[model samples]
Target: MRDPLTEKPRRKIPSRLIEVDAWIDSSLWRFGHGFSRFWESVTIFSRRFRARGLNKLAVEVACEGLTLGVAGLIVMLALAQPAMKLTANGLPQQTDYSVLFLDRHGNEIGRRGVMRADAIPIDEMPDHFIKAVLATEDRRFFEHWGIDFFGLARALSENARAGGVVQGGSTLTQQLAKNLFLSNERNIERKIKEAFIALWLESHYSKREILSMYLDRAYMGGGSFGAAAAAEFYFDKDIRDVSLAEGAMLAGLFKAPAKYAPHINLPAARARANEVLTNMVQGGFMTEGQVVAARRQPATAVDRSTTTSPDYFLDWAFGEVQKIAGDMPHRNFVARTSIDMGLQQLADESVEYHLRQFGKTYDVGEAAMVVLDDDGGVRAMVGGRDYGESQFNRATKALRQPGSSFKGYVYAAAMEAGFKPDDKISDAPITIGRWSPQNYGRSYAGTVTLQTAIAKSINTVPVRLSQKIGMDKVAALAKAMGVESNLRGDKTMALGTSEVTVLDQATGYACFAAGGMTSNRHGILQLFDTNGNLLWDSKRDMPPRRRVLSETASAEMNQMLSQIPIIGTARKAQLSMTRAAGKTGTTQGYRDGWFVGFTGNFTAAVWFGNDSFRPTNKVSGGGLPTMTWQRFMEAAHQGIELKPIPYIDNTMPERKAPKVAEEGDAPPPVRPASLTTAAQKVLAQIGMLMSSAPPLEKPEKLAAAAGDDNAVGRR
Candidate 1:
C-alpha cells in the first residue's frame, strides 16, 4: 500500500483510502496495548482475589474507605503546612565546605575546602546551554504548564519497548518541585504534591527564572551543586570558562552524578559527554564542529575534595552542640565555640599522659577533663581518655555521684549562714537525724577550723553545717548558683551522695570563681545566612544574672578551693599557678572521679567513669584531671601576666551548738526519733561496732527540715 502524499506503494484498499486510516489505527492500537498491559494485571489479581473470597472483603473495605477517605484527607491537609515538609536536618550533607578557623587574634589555623564556587547569575548563563539541558532532561520543559502527560506516556512506551524499566518519567520541574516543597519519600502522594508545586511555580515565574533555579540547585559531581560548582569541580575553571565537552558532562550528571563522576571513571564519563554533545548538535544548540572539539579536548582535571571526613571532631562536636541548640535548624547555625584547636590538642595529650602515669602508679587509667574560662564559657573539654574507644562525653554528659566535691557547696552554704572559716568544728561521726556520712578514710579530724576541714576535704564538717543550717537552705544555695540538677533535701545528700554531671559542677563552681555573678554557659555566638545577612546573635538582650553569694562569702569559698592546689588533694595541679582553685571528688565505691576548678579567668571540670555505671581503675579528680588542668593552663596562658590573691580572716558571727562524732565506724538507724536507743541498736546489728558518739554536751537537737528528699539526682 502507498500514501497519496509520498506516491510509493499503492495497491490494496484503493477505494477505502485505507493507507492513511491504517496509520491512525496502528497508533491507537499501540497506545491501547500500553494501557491494557497495565490494567490487565490488576484484573487478573482481582479474579484470584475473588476466588479466595478476598474480593468481597476488598469491596467492603473499599466502600468503607470511600466513605471516610475524604474526611481523613481533609484532616491531613489541615495538618500539613510549609514547615511540615521538613524533618530533622540529617548529618552534614555530602557537600564539601571550606573551613577557615582562626584564633581570638584572627590568625588562620585550619583550612579544608577548595575547588569552590560561590554563586552564579541568571543573565550570565548561555541561553543555548539551558535549551540543551531542556532537550536532554525535559524535552517539553518550556511547552507544558509544569508536568507533561505526553512526555510521561512516551517514556512509558519507550520503557515497554526496551523490555525493562530503563528511563524515568520525572521531569526536571518535578525534581525541583520535590526538592523545594515535598519530602523525599518515594510514593504517589509525594509525586502528586510535587506536580502541584511545579504548576504553581510555573504560573508564578517566567521560563528564565525556572531555568536559572534548575542550573543553580541541581547537584553535580564531586560534592558540587549548580553549573558554577560543577564547572570548577570538573575543569578547575569558572562556569563562564567551561568548554562544550565539560558542559555536556555536567548536564549528563543530572540523572546520577556519582555514577558518572569523571574521577570515579574517566573513560565512561567521556563517553557520556560525547553522547550529550551529539544530542546538543541534534537539538541545534551546538554545531557538529563543536561536538568534535568537545570530544577532542576532554576534562584534564577532577575535584578530589570529598575524600576526607571529619569523623571524630564532627561526631563529638555535633553531640555537644545539640545540647545547647538542638531546636535551631542545622542549615543556618553559627556556633561561636570556645573550642581552641591548640587547647583541644593539649587536652587530648594530657588525658593520654596522666592516665598513663596513673595507670603506672595506681590501677585507674580512665579519665576526663572539662575546661571553661571564667567568663562562664567552656574552653576545652575531653569527655574520656580515649574518644575513639568511647563516645560518652563524661565531662558534659555523665551524671555520677559527686562525693566530697559536693562538700564545697555545703561549706559555702554554711559560711553564708554564719559558719566562719576560722571557727572550729569537730569532724567525727556526726548524726543528723537518720543519716551519718563518714570521711573517705572512715576517720575523723578531731578539732579543726572550717578552713582546715575544707582544706583536707573533710566530709563530717559539711554534714554538720547542712544539719545546722537545714538541708533546705543548702539545696537552695546550690540551686541559686546554677546547680539546677536535683539536690537531696535530706541530710544524706549533704555528704555529696547525690549524682551530678561534671559540667554543672564546674559551672556552679565557676560562679564563685567569677565573683558570684552567674553567666549561663553558652555555645553558639551568632548566625548568618548564606547571603551573609545576620540571622541571630547570642549576645542580644540577655537577662541580668542573679547573685548567688556575697563577695565576702565567695572569697571564702575560693579560699577553700585554692587550698586544693596549694597544700591539699590537687597540689599536683599547681603548674606554678598562683591564683588557682579547685576541688577533688571521688564517688562512693570509686565508681566516678571528678576534678572541677578554675583560676581568675578560666574554669575547668574533669571527670572519669563508665556510662554503664561500672567502676574505672580507681581514678579520682586529683589523679588525671589535676595534671590535665595544669597542662592546659600552662599552654593556655603562656606569657600572660596574672596576679596573686590574698586571703582574709573570717569576721562572721558563729552559729548555735553543733553535733560532734567519736572515733568510730558505725552508721545511724533509719528515721530515728531519739539518738541513744536507735543508735545503740543499729550498731549492735552491724556486728563489728558501737559506742555512743562521744557525746557533745547537748545544747539542742537540729531543727525540723523541709526540702526534696532526693534534692540532687544524677545530672
Candidate 2:
C-alpha cells in the first residue's frame, strides 16, 4: 500500500497462496497447448486434403468426416487400455471344482461338484459335428470377415418383419470376444468394442483356430462346459463317439442350455435338435434321408445311478477332509475311503427293513450301526433309516449308555488284579452308600464261579469286583481300551451308567478283538488332489497302537465274553458259519439298547432308541439289536473264510478250571437222617439266621474251610 509506483507493495502473499496461483497458471497454459495441438492436427489434415484440388463443398464435408473419425479413434483408444487390462491374455483359464470318492477297490462310490467330461481336441472332431455347429451358429462364417454386413441386413429385416429379435448378426468371433473381454451387457459402446475385438481376433487367428476356441470355451447344459464335457455328461460317451444327432443336439444347447436340457425337457431339446438338422440340410451339409435317420435316433443319456444318495461313509469322510484341508477350496479331489459298498448297502437295507417291520412293536423310532475292522477302519456305517430324511449321522454323534456292554472293562480290570475265571464271587445283595444294588431278576445264586456269574450277567459280581479294585481303576481301563466318553468314578459306574457313542463303543470293542492293542478309528484311508498327488494317508499319519491290556487279561476277558452267546443272554447272535463274541447292554428304563460284537473279520455295534430319549416298550439288546446284528453279519461273512479270534482258545495259565463239585465236597456238613433232634433243630435255626444276615463277613475263610482255594467275596 505504501509503494504504489513500485508495482504496489504486493501484499506479502502467503507461500501456499502463491504456490496455488502458479499451479492454476500452469494448468491453464497446458490446456491451451493441448487445444492448439488438436486444432493444428485438424488444420493440417484439412490442408492436405484441400491441396489435392477438391471442391469447396467436398472440402467442408471431408473435414467434418475426418473430425468425426478422429473423435471415434480417441474414444476407442480410451476404452482399449481397460479392455486390454480386463482380457489380459485372450481368455481366462477355467477353474472347475470336482470331487470324486471311491471305495477301497477304486470303484466309484459317489461324487461331489458339477459333472464334467474329459477335454476334447478340435482336430479329432468329426466333419458332421463341425458342420452342425457352423450351420446353427453362423451361416456366413466362412465368407464374413468379422462383422457380417449381409447377415446384419438380413437379421434387421427379419426382426423388423417379426417385431422381435428373431435373429442375431453376431459372428462367432464376436461372441468369443464378448465372453473373453467384456460382461454380458448389451449396449452401443459394448457392441462397438465387440465388433472391434472380433476384427482383432479374425486378424490374429485362422478360421479353424477360432472355431476351436469357440467350441472349447462354450458353456453347455447340466453343469458342463465345453463340447467334450457336454458329450460325456449327456450321452455318457466320449466326444469322438457322439453320433450325428447327438452332435446337433449339443450344438443346439448353445442357445439356451438350461431351457433345452434333454434331462429336464426332452421335447424342447429334440425340437431344437430338429431345427439344427434342418439348417444343416439347407446348408447342403446333410441330405433329407440323413436328417430323418438322425431324428429317429433318440438321445442316449448318462446313467443316473452314479449320482445315488451318499451313505454315512461319505458324510464322515467329507467332515474329516474339511478338518485336514480347512475350507476345501480346490475344484477337484479324490477321497479313498475304507467303506465296502456292498456291505454298506446291505447294512442300510437291514436298518430300514428292521425299523419298518418291528419299529412299532419295539417302540423304537431310530437306529444306528457301525462296522469296523480290528485295525479300526470303518467298513460300513448306517447312521439312520433314511439318509434323505435326515443326515444326523447318529453312529458317530449320538451318545447313549453302553449298559452291560461296559462290564467287559470291569472284568478286564479284575483279571489284571489277579482274579481268575474259576474264582468264587458272591451274587448276593450288597449296600454301597445308600444304594442297594440287586440282580437283574431280583434273585441270587449263592457260591457261583466267576465264569458262571459272567455268563448269567449277574449285576452283583461286577459291582463287587469294581469295589474290590477302585472304581477309578475300572474307568481308567475303559479309557485305555479306546472308550472316549466321560465316566463317573462311582460304584454304580460298574453298571455302565456312563454314555458313549456307537463309534467309540465299536472302537473300544475292536481293541479287545485286536488282542489289547488300541487303534484310532477312521473312515478315510487316503486322499488325493486333482492331479493325483497324495494329500493324506491314514496309515502314515495315524498314531501307532499301544498295548493297553496284557495278553493274559485280554484272552481271559474275550473267553468270558464269548460265553454270552453260548450260554448267556445273547444266544440268538450265534452264527452258523463263524463264531462271534460280544456283550449286550440295555439301560435301566430300556431307553437305549446296544449289541457290540465281533468276529475275526469285522467288529460291529448296533444301537436302538428314540431320538427323544423316551423309553422303548421293553426292548432289550438281546432282541431287536441282536437280530439286526445277526442279519448284517450273516451277509457280511457269507463268502469270507472263518478265522479264530485273538483269544479263541487262549486261557490263563495260573488258574485251572475247577472240577465239578462231588457229593463228598458239599458245604454245611450233611448228617445221616438218624441224627439227634437237637442237632436238626440247631441246624434249622442257623439256616434262618444265615438267610437274614448279609453275605459272610469273610467268605474267603468259609471258602478255605470248605476246601476251596482263591475264593474271595465282594468287599
Candidate 3:
C-alpha cells in the first residue's frame, strides 16, 4: 500500500531510530582503529622479546619436551607389543584342562594340567596362611599400589648388604600380573610390561582378587599349580585344613619351587619355612611367641619317594588327550590311558637297574624304552632314568640314528620286490658313492642267504639290496609301516643312518606283530568328563588299521627277524617262555645302541645312549640294550599266556579280529557286526591248520637273486 506503484512514500520512521543507527556505525569504526593499533604494538613487543634469547631457550625446551614424550610413547608401545598381541579370551583363567590320569587298570597314577578347577576362594583360605605369605613375600602389600618405592629401596639396601639378591621388590599384584600374562624372562622389556600389566590388574581388580589370582596361578613343584593343589600334593590335605607350619612351607615355595619343593628337598623346604616364620615375626604380623611353635615344628611333606608317578607317560598321554578333545568346552577330564602300571614299574626298574649296573662300565648315562601291544596301544614308556632329574621324554621326543635295526625295512622292501628270505646275496665288501658299509666286526661273510646276512647283521647285504630295489621304496615302506620320523632316501639310510624315536621303532616293529597291518600308535584309550560322559574312545574315533605290507612280505620279514633272537646279534633278547622276533641296531662310534624286537603279545624298542651324544664304551645293540630288553620282557610276559609270533612256529591259537559290538549296545558303534557262523567256522579251520603246520626250515643253499653288477657302484 505504501509503494502504491510509482508514488512517493511518506516518512513513517521515528527520528530517534536514525540517530541510533548513526551512533552504532561511528562506534564500530573507532573500535576497528583501536584494535589495529594495539595488534601492531604487541607485534613490536614480541620481536624485542625474541631478541633477548630467553624466548629461544623456552622454544627449544618445549621442542625437546615434545620429542622426549614421543620417543617414550614409541618405546612403551614396543615394550607392550607382546601383551598387545595376546587375546583376552580367558584372561587370568587357565584354558588348559585339569587331567586326572588313570592307568590301564583304572587306578589313579598321577595328575596333570594347571588344576584351576580346584582353586579355593580367598575367603576360604586360612588367615594365618595369608599372613605367612604376605610377611614372607610382600609385607607392605596392602599399603602400596601396584608398585612400592619404599619396599624397592629397602630390598635394594638388603641386597647390597648381602652382596646378592636376598629379596624381591615386586608387590603381590605385580607377581600376579607377571604370572598371568608374561613369561619368566628376566629382561628390561619384560619388566616394563609386567609393571604396566600390574597397574592394569590393580585398576581392574581389588587387592583380595589380585591375591587370589596369584595363589591360583603360581606354579608349585611336583606338577602342581595353585596353593590348593600344592597343599594337597605336599601335605595330603586341603588348603583350609593346613596348619601354620604347613602354610609357611607352602608360602616358601613361591620364591623357588624346584629348589624348595618339600617332596624333593625336605631339609631345604624346612629351612625356608623357618625363614618364613622369622619374617612373620619381624613384619609384626605375628609375635615371637605366636611363631615359636611353627619355627620349632617344621612342616613335613608326605612321603612320595616310594610312589612311582610315571610322569613321563602321563605327560605324553596328556598331550594326546589335548589333541583328541582340545576343542571341547569342558576343561576337566578323567583320562583312561593305555599304560599298565605293572609293566611301567617293571620298565622303570629295568632301566634303572641296567643304568646302575652297566652304565658306568659302558659310560652310558641315558636310556629309553617304549612298549606297544599288537593293537598299537602303548603299554609302558621309560623316558629316562628318573622323571625328577629330567622330564624330556626320550621315548617320544628324541630322534637318534637307528643303525642296523633299520635293515628290516630295506629287507622288507626287497621281499616286496619278489625276493625271498632265503634268496642268496653276496656279503662281500661293497661300496656305493664312496660309502663302503662294513659289518659290525668289519669282516665279510662272502656269499650268504638273506636270513644269515640279517642274523649276523652284515652291512653290505642291505646296501646291495637297497641298490637293487631303490632307496625310495625302502623309505616309503618304512613310512607305511608307521615310522613317523623322517626317512632320508640316501644310500646310508639302508643302514639306518636316518634318525627316529623309540616310539617309531616300536611302531614299525609292531607292523610285523600285527601281520603287516598299520600300527596306529596311540597312548590314550578312553577319555571321559567329570560327569562320566565318554568324550573320546580311541577304538571308535581312531583311524582303522590298513594293510601297509603284503602278507607275503610281512611273513618273510618276520621269518628273517625271528632268526635274530635265536642266532643273530640280538641273542640276549630271547625270552624264556615265548618266541621273539626283532632286529638289532648299532650306530657308528657306538654313539647309539638299539634293540627293537617284538613278541606276539608286545613290541618294544630299547635305546641306550648318552643324552649329549657322547660315544659309549663299545656298547653294542647286542650288549646293554638287549640285556635290558630281556629283563623287561621276561617280567612283562609273566602270568600271561605267550602268543606265537606270526610266520614263526604257531603253538598258540591264532589271533582273531576284535568282535564288533552289535547295534543298540553302545553309542560308539564299532564295525558293522560280529562275524557270521560260516565265516567263524572257516576261520577256525584256518587257525587249526596254522597251529598244526610245521615251521619253514632254512635251506642249505639257494641261488643268488639276479641283479645289476653296477647297481651299487663305488665312486
Candidate 4:
C-alpha cells in the first residue's frame, strides 16, 4: 500500500529512489520471517530435549567439545613457529656441561666432566651395540615414525590406572628430540614440542642417520654422552671392541642413566644389563647361548679418572636423587648430600691409618667403614682402602658375612621373650641337627649370665637361644632391626652366617642407640637443582620410625653390649671420652671381620677383609676393626659432651609399694636403684602428692602388660 501511494506521490521525487525504498521493505520482511521460523525451531528442540532429560547432558557435551577444539587450535598455533624453527635447525650444537656435588655444608665436594664426551660417526659403532639399543629401548624403531602410537595408548592406559604418571612411552626419536631441544619437564607444552621435534627428526633424516645422531648425542651415564664415550668410560675400550654384555649395559642406561650407572651401582647395572640381554633374545637380536656367555663375562667399570673421599657418598646421594626425582640430567646440576666432609675426612684418615699400620702384618687388603647419626644420617663413609685402587663401595655395596656382629639381634629377640640379662645360659658346645657350634677360642664357659655370654660373643649361647625360641623369631627380629639380607634360617644363622652390607648392619645397630626406634640410613639430607630449587629434604621426607624392639629390651641389650667396649671382644674400641656399645665379628675362616658399635650420638660399622675372600693369617674382628673404630670415634666425638646411653639394671627389686609421705611431712625419698638421678627427683616429687598409690609392677610384668613380650593373653 505504501509503494502504491509512493508511486502516486513519486511524481515529485526520482523514480530510482522509489524503487530503492520498495527493495529495502521487501528485504526487511523476508529477514523477519526467517528469524521467526528459526526461533520456533529452537524452542521445539529445547522442549524435546527437556522432555527426554537430555538437555543438561547435551549442553555439557557440547561445551566440553567446544572447549577441547578451541584449546587444540590454540596449542597448534602456539607451537607452530617453534616447531618450524627447530626443523630448520635440523640438529642442535654441543654445549658445555658441569655437574657439581655438594657436601652437607653446601661446599662443592667434587665436579664431574666439564665437557661433553667426544662424538663418533654411526658407521664406526659395532652392530651388536646398535642392535642392543634398538632391542632394549624400542623394538619397533624401524616400523614407527617419531612416535609409537601403540606404546602411547598403552602408556595412557597405564597412567590412567595408576592415577598418575608411572610410565613414559616416548620413542627413541622422541627422546632424542627432547634431549636435544626441549626442557626435561613433564608438561603439555613441553610434550607438544617434543612430539613436533620428533616428527621433524623423522622427516628430515634417514633411519640410519637418525640412529647415528641419536647414539652420538645420547646420554649413556657416568658422565658419558655417546655410545662410543660410554664404551670408553666404562670398559676402557673402543665402541667397536665392546663385548655383548658391555653393549647391553650401555643400552640399559638410556632408561635411567644414574640408576644403571656402572661406577655408581655395579649390581644394579649388571641386573639391568641382564634385562637387556633377555630383551635381545626375545627380539631375535641375540641367541640364548650368546646371552648366557655375555652374562658370564659381566662388564667391569674402569676406575674413575679422579677420586675423592666422598666418592661413595656421591654415589649414594645420586641414588637418593633418583628416588626423589626421576629422569635427572647428567650435568648442570647440584646434589646436596648428608655427608659431613670433616667426618668423611676423619673416617678416611682413620681407615688409612689402620690400613697402613697393620695392612702388611694382618694381611688386610681392604677395609670399609660407615658412620651415621642417631637418626640415620650418614655422616661419613670409607668405601674402600683407596677409591683409586677400586671404586667398589664396600661400605654400602659389598655384602659379606656379618659374623658375631649379628648376635645382638638374636639376644634382643631372647630378651623380648622374657629372658633377662642376669639369666644363666649354657655356653658349652651344643649340637642341633648335626651342627656343632663352638666358641671363638674353642673353649666353653659351661654356664654364664646372658650379659657375659653376649659380651664374650659366645657362639653356643645364641645358637641354643635360637633353638629355644624358634629360628623364625630370630630371623624376624633381625629383619625388624633393619637387617635386609637374607637369613639362612638354620642354626648357623645364630653365628651370622648370612652376608649383609655394612650400611644395613650399621643402620640396624643404630636402633639400639635410638632406643629401639628404627631409621633408614640415608646420605642425602636435601637435594637442590641447578636453579636453586629444593628437590627433597629429609626433615620433611623422612619415613615414620619403625619400632622394632621394646624400650626395655633395647635398654637391656645396650647394658649387655656396652660391656663389649669395656671387657668384651671389642675392648680396644673403647672411647675414653664417651661410653660405647658394640660387637665384634670374625667369620669362620677369618675371611671377614666386622666391628659394629654405637654411642649416644652416633653409630658406626667397620669391615676388614680381602676382596677375594682370602683368609688372613690371624686377623680377627677384635684387632683391626676395633682399632679403626676407636680412632674414628675418638675424632668424631672430640667436642661432643659425654651422654650416657639408656640402660636398665637387671638387679632392680621386684614390685613394691612406695612409702608415701604423711600429711605433707616430707616427700618420701623414693630412691629407686634403677632410676637415674634426674628420674629419682621427679619420682620423689610425685610421691609427695600420691600418698596411697598402688605398688609398681616389675619390669617384666610391665613389659607383659604392654604386650612387648610373649606373655599369655598378650597380642
Candidate 5:
C-alpha cells in the first residue's frame, strides 16, 4: 500500500548518505558543536607572536587553562555523591510501657495498649532471619562501608539500559542511618548525608550490635515497633516461640506492612512468610524442620477477657492502683493484685441489681459497693450506684457522712474504754453547753444502754458517752484504728458530722474483719519481668494485728451491731447468712446513706448520695445501701470462709463512766434535782440503757453546759 516514492530511498544523496548519518550521531555532533563554539568564542587581533602586551608564552598559558577547565567538567560528572557525617545529641528513645488490670487469679482482666515489650528478646533471633532480611532489603548491609560504589555503578548502568533510575542500592546501615538521623527527602544530598552517617555508625558499633539495636528500635508495623513487639502482635508468642516461618513473616512486614498483613490476606502473608522461610533455610539460619513446625500451626491469639470493654471496675482499679502504687505503665511493672474477677463480676452485678430495686421502689438510679478480703485485700469494688450515669470511683473517693454507721465507731471506742453495753445513760434533755443531739426518731429513749444506743443508732447516747470518755480520746482512738479522719469536735460528731471517704471507712471496718490488725490498703504485690525475674517486690501488706481491736472489744461491738436487724437500724439486711455485722448510716437531711459491714472473711462498704447534695425523700441506708451491701457480700463471700466474730465477753458488770466535757472553757451537762436519782442511776448504769427506757421529766435546767467544740472528721 505504500507509495513507490516513499518506499524508494529518496535519491541516495549524492553517495555516502550513510556517511552523513554517521557524522550526525550524538557523539560526533557533540564534538562538532564544541569545536564550532570554540571557534565562535575565539578572538584574535594579529599573529600571537606579534602581540604588543602579551608574549607567546601568555597566549599558550591561557589556552592551557581553558583546556584544563573542560577536563574538570568531565571529571565532575563521573563522580558519585559521598556519605554523610555522624553527630550526637539525637532524639531520646521513644519508649512506652502499658498498664494492665489483673484479677486475683493472675488473669489479665483488662489492658491498655503499648504494653508490647513484655516478652521477646532481640538476641534470640535466628541468624538466617537476619540474613534473609538483609538480602531482601539491603544486601550490601555489611559489605558496604555505609555506601557501595560498585552497586551504584551497576544501578547507573541498569538505569542507563532502562532509561532512568528504577531501583536504589541503599544498605541496611544506610537505611538505619537515614531512618534514625536524616530527613526522608529523596535526593542526592539526602542520600549522601545518609551514607556518611551510616559509615560513622558502622565505625562505632559491631555488625551484630548494630543489627540488634536496629531490630530493637525499627518499626515493624501493626502499631508495634521493634522485633519483640512485632512478634507478639502477629503471633501472640514471644521471640523464643518464633520459628523460621514466623520469623520470616515478621521480617517480611518491615518493608511494607500495609501491602502484606496476615489479617488482611493470610495467603499473601503466608507466601511472603514462606519466601522468608526459604531464605532462612538456604542461608542456614534455621533448619527445614523448624520451618515446618512454625507452618504446622496458625498464629495464636491472646486470651479473651471480660475486662476487654471499658468498665466500672476496670476504670476504678486503674485509677486506684495508680493512687496507691504510683503512676506506672503496664510494662513498667508486673503487678499481682488482690482482686477476685469472679467476685468483682458478682459485685458489679449486685450493684446493678440493687440499683434496679431502687429504680422500682424509690424511682432512684444509683448505688456503690466495696468488698475486701478477710486480710484486708481489696477484692471487688463498684464505684457508682449506676455505672450508666458515671465512672467515678465512689468506693475510694466519695466523701460522705456515715450517718448511724458512725455510731459504731463511737460505741466501739466507748466500749473499749471500759463502758458496758448494759449500763444506762439518760437521754432526757441533757445538754453540755449549747448543743443537744437527737435520736433517729427525734424521740428520747431515756436510760439507753451503750449497746442498745449503737444498735438503734441512738444519736443522743454517743453524745452522752463522748461526754464521759472525752471526745478527744474518742477521736484519737478512731485515728489509731485506721479511721484516718479527724473525728468530729462538735456534739454532732456523735452523729457523724464529719466526712470520711468510702475507702478509709471500708478499710477501717476491715480492721475488725482482719482480726484487729491493720490492713494496709493496697493493690500491687510484685513486679517481675515477663521472664519471671524480680524487679520490685511490694511487701507493704498491712497485716491484721491487735491494731484491729481486742477480741473482746470487737466481739462486743459485733454482738451489739448484730442487734441492728432485730432491735436496731439495719433490719432490712436480714438475709440468710450465718455470721454478719453491719450498720446503716443516714446523714442529716438524708443527704447521704451508708451501709458498712463485715463478715469473718470480708468487709464491705456501700454509699448512696446525689451529686446535687439533695436529701433523698425518706431514703435511708436500710432501704437502698443495705440491698447493695447484702447482694455484694453474698457473692463476695461465696468461696470465702465465713465465721463468727471473735468471742467478745460482754458479761462483765456495766462499768460506770465519768461525765466528761471537752478541754478548755466548756461547761459540762447538768443533772437536774428532779431527775437526780434517775440521772445517777442511768449514769451509774450507763451501759444498761436501751430504747425501752421511759423518758424522764426535768425539774430545772442542766447544771454543767457543753463546750463549743469544732472537731470534725477530715482525712
Candidate 6:
C-alpha cells in the first residue's frame, strides 16, 4: 500500500530469539573443542600403549575378537529368522489320522497317518527297548542339555579315522527337532534352526517327555512313524511286549529307516542291529553277556516281503480323500479306493519285469503306468520302480512330452470340423513360417487318407491339419477330453511338444473308451468314519458326465486310432482277446517314449524313460512301452466279460498265413510319392554310400545300422 514495489521493507528480530541463537552457537563450539581435546588425549595414550609390542598385540587380538563376535551375532540372527517365525504355541497338535486304506474287494492293503492313541508312554515301553534306544542314539541323554558336544567330537574323530561317516553327530533331541519343525534338507540354515529348536525343546519338556516325543515322531519307514508304530508294523506286536532282539532291530531303524527296515532288507537290518547291540555294550547300558544272545538271534520281522504295498495308489487316493472331505470334522477315515489289488499287482509286475529285463539294455531306469476302467475309475497305478527309493509320483506328477500321442486330439478336432477318416491330406513337407515338421523317417508319404496318416504317425499331416482347423480349437478339444495339463497354442502344439502326465494321458484316453463322454476320473470310491458312517461317496458326489464329441466324430476317431495296434506304430499293443486302439508318442532325442492305448474295457497309458531326463538307448513307444502295455492288458482281461469299444466291432478276425515268395523272385520295390527333393537326394546318397562300402558283417556295424533304422522309423 505504501509504494511497496519500489520500497525495501525490513523486519525486526526479537531480542529473545537472538540471545537463544547465540547461546546455541556457543554451546556447539564448546562441545566441539572439548571433544577435540579428548580425542587428542586418547590418541596420545593409544600411541604410547602401542609403542610397547605386547600392548599392540593385545589390542590387535582384542579388535579381531570383537569383529568376529559381531559378525557371528549377525549370522546367528539371520539363521534364527526362520525359526523365530514359528509360533511358541507349544508343540503342534497331532492332526495326523490313522487312515486304513482298502482295495476294491474290501481287503486292508495298507495304513497311513498317525494317531495320538498310538503313542506309548515312556514308562509303559519295555525296559530293554528304552535302554537300546538311549545307548545307540544318545548315550549322554541325561548328561547334556540338548546338543552333545563331546559326542559330536567323538563322531568327528571316528569319521576322520575311518575316512567316512560311520556315526551320526545329532543327539536324539536334535533329531526330534528335525522331525517336528524342520525339513530333511542339510543346509546351514536348517541345521541352525534344528539346534535352536532342540534347545527350545529341552527348555520346555522334561527328559522323559523329550524321549517319548522322539520315539513317537521319527519316521521308521514302511510308511510308519515312531518306534511304537514301527514295532507294531515290523513285529505285529505292541511296544510293551517287544523282545530284546526285536528292540535291537527297531532301534537300528532310527538311523536310516529305508536302508535298514527289516521288511525291505533283512540282512542289512540284522547287520545294523548287531551294531546297535555293540553300542549298548560299549555304552555300559548292558553287559556283553546280556546282548550276546540278542545279537546271535537278531530279529525276524513278519513275512511281509511278498505283499506289495500299493503305496502309489494310496498316495493318490489320499489326496482325493482330502479334496472330498477336507472340511469334515472327522480325522480318522477308512477309504475304499477303486484300486483292484490284482490289477495293481499285475501292473507292478509288468512294469518291474520289463524294466528288469530290458531297462539296462535300453538304458531306461524308470517307468510309470496308469490303468482306468471305462467309467473313469482308476484301477491301478505304478509310479516308479521302487517306492522306497523315490516317493515322487511320476504317474500323476511327472510332466513329460507326450510326442505323437497328442495327435489324437488334433485329429479329433479335424473330425469335429467336418473332416472324415477317409479325407485326404497332403503328407508332403509343408512349412508354417520357419517350422517345417518332418516325419520320423525324414520321409513323407504322398497324399494319404487321415486314417493312414495318423496310423503311420506322419508328422507333417497333423501340423498341416492343425494350421487349417486352428490350434485353439484343438487345445479346447483336448481340454474337453480330459487333458488337465496346460496346452500352448503354438504351431508345435500339433506335434505334442507340450508336456502331460501319464495320468492325464490315461484320463484322456478313457474319454475315448467311454464313448466320447467325459471321463470323471476318480480314485476314492467311498469314505467312512470310525463308526462306519458314510461321509462321502464318489458315485453321488461326482459331477455328471457331459458329451465331449458327437457320435459320428467319436466313431471316426476310434476307427482311425484302432488301426494303431493293428498296423500302426503300436502293433505290439494288440490284445489277444479284444480289440485295442491307441497312439504312440516318441519325443525328440528319445527322452520319453509313451504308448497310451484303450481297450473296450480298460484304458492304460505307459511311459518309459530315465528320471534324470537322460535319453534312452533309442527306446520307442513301439518297443518296450507297447510290450508292457500288452503284458498288463492280457492279464487284466482274463476273467471279465469283454466290452466292445463304442462304434467299433470287437469280434476277433482269423489270422491268415503269409504267402511265401517263389524262390529267386524278389518283391517289387516301393517308394513314397510325397518325398521332397531333399529327402530323395539324401536317400540317393545313402544308397550310394551303402553300395560302395564293404558288407556290414561285423556285429557292431550291423548294430549301428540297425539303430539308425530304428531311429528313422520311431513314432
TM-score of each: 0.49, 0.52, 0.65, 0.53, 0.50, 0.71
lDDT score at residue 708, model 5, on the 0-100 scale:
9
Query: Per-model C-alpha lDDT, please?
Result: 0.62, 0.75, 0.81, 0.76, 0.62, 0.83
Per-residue lDDT of candidate 5, residues 54-149 (tens digit): 666787888899999899776543432333223554433443544444555445554332433442444677655676686566666667776777
Q: Candidate 4 lDDT (Cα, whole model)? A: 0.76
Candidate 6's TM-score reads 0.71
Q: Pick by lDDT: which candidate is best? A: 6
Candidate 4 residue-wise lDDT, 1-715, digit = tens: 3677667765756777889999999999999999999999999888765633486778888889999999999977777677778768567755343345666654556533324433566777878888899987878899999999997897799999999986668898998887777644446777888888888889888888888878877766654567876787788898888988888888988888767788878999999999999889999998998789888988888876343437666656655655666555533445557777667877887788778867888888889999988768888888887553344678877889999998988999998999999999787777777888788779988889999998888889998898899889999988887888788788788899888999888989988988888867777766544434455678777787878889889889998888776667887777656677899999978899899998887899999998878898677888888777877887777655445666633232232222222112422121112334366468746744553444334322422322223322101
- Residue pairs clashing in model 4 are none
lDDT of 3: 0.81
Q: Of the candidates shown, which would achieve the greatest TM-score relative to the real structure? A: 6
Residue 455 lDDT in model 4?
86
True-vs-predicted CA distance for residue 603, candidate 3, Å? 0.9
Q: Candidate 2 at residue 607, lDDT?
A: 93
Error of 1 at 550 (Å): 0.5
Which residue segments of model 3 deviate by more than 4 Å?
A: 1-95, 115-227, 240-244, 251-291, 302-307, 650-715
**Candidate 6: stretches off by over 4 Å:** 1-96, 121-223, 254-268, 282-287, 303-308, 426-443, 488-491, 653-715
| Candidate 2 residue runs with Cα over 4 Å from true position | 1-99, 111-308, 326-332, 649-715
Once model 2 is optimally superposed onto the true structure by TM-score, how far is the C-alpha of residue 540 displaced, in angstroms? 2.6
lDDT (tens digit, per residue) of candidate 6 on 334-451:
7778888778878988888789877888999999999999879998999988765556789998899999999999999999999999989898978889887888889977999999
For residue 189, what is the lDDT in candidate 3?
72
Cα lDDT tens digits, model 2, 533-624, are: 45678878778888988999888878887778777777767765667789888898899888989887789999999877789998888877
Candidate 5, superposed: residue stretches over 4 Å from native: 1-97, 112-331, 360-363, 385-389, 485-488, 535-548, 648-715
Question: What would the per-residue lDDT of candidate 1 be over residues 1-715, giving only the tens digit for each residue?
Answer: 7568665344454845877888889999999998999899999887775633786788888989987998888875654433234322421232233222222222222222222234467677655456557767887777888888888998899999999886778777777776555544455566666776676678777877777777876656554557776776677777876666677777777776766778766777777777777777776777888568767886555656434212233333444444444354423222234455555666666666656555555456456666666556555666665442333456655667887778778888887887777999887787666766778768886999988887788888877787789889888887887776787687778767787777778778878777777856653343322222334444562356767887778888877777666667776666443457778888776677777777665777777655556666666667655656666675665544443332423222232211212202322112112224255356535522322233222101100000112222111
Candidate 3, residue 208: how far the Cα is off, in Å: 13
Clashes of each: 11, 2, 0, 0, 44, 0
Residue 691 shift from truth in candidate 5, angstroms: 60
